[model samples]
Target: MFALSGCAQQASSPGADAPSGEEPAMPDNGDCPVIDSRDWKAWVNAMPGPGAETTLIVEGAVDMPTPGYTFSWEAGMADRSAVPAQRLHLTATAPDGMVTQVITTENVRYEGPAIAKEYRAAAVMCGDELLAEITDVVTAE
Candidate 1:
């Protein structure tokens, strides 16, 4: 069984001239980039349930620079310490500006030292009927 106990933090600033598609030093959890709004639709639709086509936003506050670090999700099923963390459900509007449901299943799990820049993410599907999904990963900063 995989555990969510091990993870590290990563910090990087988006370069002034950085082009699109470049990943920035992301907080543990928060909003998806503004550019991701349109793409979020396909993501929510790819989940296992119908009507999961919304862009649910989750936020995390980090106290890194100190001792242990933490990540949190809004209305998420698992907490930072939930052993064998399973699934996370998020709610948001679809790309068309219509609201829909979104469900995400836990697939990839990671745990370890921050130096490795390791973390976990999952493939999420959304949409009332069905749409698409993309793999998202979370690393420290």
Candidate 2:
């Protein structure tokens, strides 16, 4: 299991019996009014399977100032260079209004395909801030 320091939130991945090459749907939070916090801890897990297909799961949690904040995995793009890497983007949004002062956590999850043995690392980013770097990628057999 991939681990992130100071992050207690856990993300679930698609089951092994699920159809191959089917991407999961992102949560609908398009109507949120305010942009939530970027303070987060991120992690990435690589699951290698047959046919040289690798599933990369990026997970993270943001520190919100109040409740009612929702987070989602915006996108994940692979940098195909001499050394490949995956860049996972995240966003946190909340309703417009004043809420009680309670610290909240919003978790995000992204599951996608990656070329097995190709990527050297995966980086999770929120806006311009780098949240986490995962270097222990499981290469193809």
Candidate 3:
């Protein structure tokens, strides 16, 4: 239930100081990559309870400004009743102190009560931007 958004561009070639053959490091441009949907996973699992208790879990990663940044789910679900799909939101928060210029990868996850309708796909959103869309959903007992 989080909503986050940002723009990012791939870092250019390594600078003159960098050693040859070394991969170029991410620049301090404060930009994050748009996560590919293939990197995301969504699933539903039944829980132990008298009734049919179940939980929906979504896992993915987001590029943050620095290693000190943290990511989390927002607080509500988007209404996608028109389609057999679910839309989840996420957010990122930067640390309070000084941080390095390197871009960091933050793994984000969410586990909540499963909704009544089973969705065939799940879309991860950051504000109005679509981060990823998990089309293959797993259901487990």
lDDT at position 85, candidate 1: 27
Q: Report the number of clashing residue pairs per model.
A: 22, 0, 7
Better of 2 and 3 by lDDT: 3
For model 3, what is the alpha-carbon lDDT of residue 129?
Answer: 69
Model 1 residue 138 distance off true place after TM-score fit, in angstroms: 4.1
Model 1 agreement with the true structure over 1-141: per-residue lDDT tens digits = 245544444454555345677734543333431112223311112233564332322222211222221232232232354221223433332243433333322222122212112213332322121112233433322
lDDT of 1: 0.28
State the C-alpha lDDT per candidate. 0.28, 0.59, 0.67
| lDDT at position 39, candidate 3 | 57
What are the TM-scores, per candidate, against the unseen true structure? 0.20, 0.53, 0.64
RMSD in order of candidates: 21.8, 18.9, 12.8
Candidate 2 local lDDT, 58-134, one digit each (tens): 55566666788666665567776865787777666665788886667666677766544456777876666666777
Candidate 3 local lDDT, 1-141, one digit each (tens):
233333444565457456878645644323333332335898888646687667788997676646876666753565556435777777656678877867667778888777743667878777566778888887786
Candidate 2, clashing residue pairs?
Answer: none
Model 1 residue 95 distance off true place after TM-score fit, in angstroms? 16
Question: Model 2: residues >4 Å from true position, as ranges?
Answer: 1-53, 139-141
What is the C-alpha local distance difference test score of candidate 3? 0.67
